[model samples]
Target: MTVTSAPETYPETYSAGAYWGARKESPEDCARRTAGFLNLLAECDPFLSHWYTPARSRRDARKHPLMPPDVATLAELFRRGMNREPGGPAIEELGFRFSFDNGGATGDCATLRINGGMSSEAVPNHCVLNVPWRGPNADRLLTAAVLTKAVRAMVLSWEPDWALAGSSAYKMQYPEPDSAPFSLGWITYLSRRIGTVPPLPAPVRIEPVEDRGTLIILTPERFTVANPEHVALARRVRELLVQAGLMQ
Candidate 1:
């Protein structure tokens, strides 16, 4: 019920027409891009998540029969193409149209609580992005927020059955206790686990258990690479949003 960090956007639901288009990529091309992303992620940091190579190998090598990676080939129908319809939901005050499909979330200063269908892996989905932001990055935040929706759609397009991809969540705590993390973050693919749910990546330690369940947390001060490639991924993600017309 209580949220850790972020602002306020009340729950408002509306139907949306698909805003995504389609793009076609050859299998070899998909592999090259997957491999490229793996390399880019490594460039963002050194110690790899043990899950990276295996996931890429299976998806890129054209192994996963069900997994047709729509990572970069995200057409208009590619990801969160839901709100582009003529009668799509719009933020009247701000004059920006948005749609809520997966589910809702509450944002606090440093933490987030993903609600309903968005937090269920069994539902066949992708990781919901819940980044915290402030005044200076308002535009960035708006675009990033929309970007989050599409990215999840993108992730699901690739590995819709990712073990914990759509199922779990991470929350950041402020006024962090001696045991709790001062902040939290995860790599893009880290949420796109290929097979069974794996253990938490390096730099991430289990904080004290909550009444609900044990949380996958990151205490950046101690864990150097809690999110080795988030910055890089964020930049690229923005690019994707712009190209997809979710921004501007």
Candidate 2:
């Protein structure tokens, strides 16, 4: 008798992010990084090209175009977004927080959230990109290849300790270890500050992200937790990474 395999389940949404421990920076510094990141992201995909500052209304949002990012404008936006205590003054330790998005239909759009300029070693500064579940371009843009570019863009622009791109479900299944620089994903970027990436078994490819560090591609196709093969491979790779001192 012939049997049919169960359908695979995948997360409805995916996200990419870069993270690093506290590093003190000014609004200008954060703006510079933000501008550079957006430019890199635009080159990664057409869907990621346009962005707008968050505002009370769509009309107001369009008044400020985040793309072709103006360093001066971004610096002003970051300054306005500074963490303040009630009505007292800007809290230096809390850092600057800002969010923007590529305006479009629900599924077609994406949000970029940023938190930087912190001085506390305990807090992590990050740039996160969130993509929706379904959309007109979803079929084409949501592939492992595109997501890998997104992660690479983040790594190149931020030069964070680590960066990752994949479904939220996969990340939930394999949360990042406190001592590890980053969690595995469809594409994971590790800074040299973390350590060298050791070789792994087949289908897993590793490439350099300039002089920054390495990019590990788990699979050329979609990686889903529902697939035992995918999960097993990720676990195995994680084990090897830890053994190689890339993770703890």
Candidate whose TM-score is highest: 2
**Where does candidate 2 clash, by residue pair?**
none
Question: Per-residue lDDT tens digits of candidate 1, residues 1-248?
Answer: 99698776532111101111122333333344343433332232222111211223334423322123234432212222322346676222221111111111222111111111222222212223332233332223323223233333333333322111110122221122343211122222222112112344444433321121223322233112234453343334434434544333
Which window of ten consecutive residues has the lowest lDDT sum in model 2? 132-141
Q: Give the lowest summed-lDDT range of ten residues in model 1.
A: 12-21
RMSD of 1: 19.6
Model 2 RMSD in Å is: 4.7
Predictions in order: lDDT: 0.27, 0.85
